[model samples]
Target: MSAAAAATARDALRAATDAIHARLHGLPALQALAEGRIGRAGYVALLRRLLGFHAAVEAALADAPSLGPSLIPWGIDIAQRRRAGLIEADLATLGAALGASAGPVPLAPLPALGTVPRALGCLYVTEGSTLGGRQLARALDGLLPPGEAGRRFLLGHGARHGAMWRACCAALEHCGAEPARRAEMLAAAEATFLAFEAWFAGAP
Candidate 1:
């Protein structure tokens, strides 16, 4: 896309999900993370659950034709990102430190998000999570008796988070600018947030 077109698309994507991102930020699961309501084992539980959920999300993306092709230019493939591995590393380090065993966390069923546009919406939500991961890392740091252990995923892309998110917004703007497409994408992103909230509900 040309510079002007990319800018327009980015703006549209940003405007479209402003409310949805706000709602997700207000969720109990995210609130708990921000408040540091969970401890070492709680964090480990979260990691396991998120890892499983991510695996399922990857499967859906692979199965969904639109999502993969849409994000390929921006390299949004979640599998290649190795986010799940980062989560597992955190779990192992955190669990081993606490002398707690990490077990298989039950997977949450992905929302049936429907269609290619909707799946791209789902990708938007997931990719956008890295921004929040920075906050989560800060909250975890405040967990009293803090250590540098367990920060692979939540550490996110560090200095690169902004660039990644911008790329996603650009893609969204390009693909979801139409009224029908925007609606489908927004619905999928909302569903993804709900699915994530439910998945984290079981974390303890």
Candidate 2:
């Protein structure tokens, strides 16, 4: 990639990251609830917002061509995994907080991949199943310019994922969750992003 294009990509990544952090800060009460530092209603509100914000992020990222292909799948995977892991973890934490264990609590499942809006598919190749890592990597390689811009974009995404994962961890930890469990969930989030990062790096 030319230096100018690389710079633009880097700037775009930074802008996205900033947007996400700003949203996180907007919900101080939710942050408190996730930490297990608030009331029942507050916790529920936080969870609701988290789910919505995650989807919104996906929708927004889907619009940026440089990020669209790589991020769409990453977003889908993270949303699904986070929905499942948080529900399991929340039930355990809430039960502990209330002094009782309970049956599995239900969560809103991720929107079926097909149900994802047509707008999101603008840059994606529609297919029956999820794209494998290798396929995604190849696609991104073709999209990303070779040079500093491509490298910076990959690094910026890695950094953004790290930041988002930390926010999730902070919320879970506040909820009286076990450290090990929190690590496991965060690891899954990291793995999803890292797969993309590796793909971008290995691209010709």
**Candidate with the greatest TM-score versus the true structure:** 1
Question: Per-candidate TM vs. native?
Answer: 0.73, 0.29
What would the per-residue lDDT of candidate 2 be over residues 1-204, giving only the tens digit for each residue? 431232332232223233333443334553453343555555444434333333333444444455434434434333322222332344344342223363322222232222223222211211101122123223334433443232221122332444554443333333214334333333333332333233323322
Extract clashing residue pairs from model 1. none
Candidate 1 vs. true structure, TM-score: 0.73
Supply candidate 2's per-residue lDDT for 14. 29
lDDT over C-alpha atoms for residue 36 of model 2: 36
Model 2 Cα shift for residue 56 (angstroms): 8.9
